[model samples]
Target: MLKVQEIRELIKLIDESHIDEFSYETNGTKVSMKKNGGQIITETPTETKPATPQKPQPVQEEELKPQEEVVEKKDQETAAEQSSNYDQEITSPMVGTFYQSPSPDQGAYVQVGDQVKQDSVVCIVEAMKLFNEIEAEVSGEVVEILVKDGELVEYGQPMFRVKTV
Candidate 1:
């Protein structure tokens, strides 16, 4: 259960952050909040008791390690396979609305077949009213633009694929 002060702090943090919705559940208590325009709407906390007492599951550290290693190995292999298809990818550094140009009237920073050097501004990501310039970290030619202008992008989401020189 969260205290009133803790809940208020959570609300304030969420309001300041890029998160549009938040939900937390613990010990049968659930709290949900959503943002509408600039207002934060918080749902009344709900508390429910379990119909039956449940036994806690026992865990072995030894059992967890192998599974974790296997999952990590698989993820690495999948990432390698994807990266092999493109020399490099320009990915969003934060969750925000992706904009290809500085403004509606301006030309896009980069497009397919465009050559870019490291530190070249490739796009902008607007979060919490701040427009952050996204850079191409690798020197390359833009082979594909993965995201459309004005689209909502998630952290680490690929925005462009570049063929490194």
Candidate 2:
């Protein structure tokens, strides 16, 4: 069986790499992890002997917590959608720190309400000391900046929302 720290390290390594799915099994223990929509899901199914069938019972109060969390997440998503009137977005291509300007003393590349061409460089994402300029893939007006300067961004995270022409 893998220790908690070992599992955490494994997850970090997998997230930093391009691999999507990983699995390991030994001595009847199984561990599996997969990336879905940029979220890592882990499963460790144990081997147990089959039990005699029994009558079903109502779910306990504790069992309802997960359902409540799901509902809360849905509500948050709906609120965000209502707040932003955008047709497109500029997403971070990798996990990194978001930068609004080329340098600390320089002005931001683009601000809210700025018009952008398809090839316009709107921001930069620095990963592993490499600064990568992120472009606007669609001609549009910048409707929102989703992340703040120097904030850590996840891969595929939307950095800017645009109203496309």
Q: How many clashing pairs in candidate 2?
A: 0
User: Candidate 2 lDDT, tens digit per residue, 1-165?
Assistant: 654335546767886888889998877877677777343232222113222352122234348779989999998997688556888878876678999999999999999999999789999888779787877878989988989999999877889989988
Residue 152 of model 2: what lDDT?
Answer: 99
Q: Which stretches of candidate 1 lie over 4 Å from their true place?
A: 1-85
List all candidate RMSDs to the true structure: 13.4, 11.6
lDDT, each prediction? 0.79, 0.78
Q: Residue 106 deviation, candidate 1, in Å?
A: 1.1
| Most accurate candidate by TM-score | 2
Give per-residue CA lDDT, model 1, range 11-107, as digits (tens): 6687688888899999898878776634323222111222233322123545787999999999999878767657988887667899999999999
In order, how many clashes per candidate?
0, 0
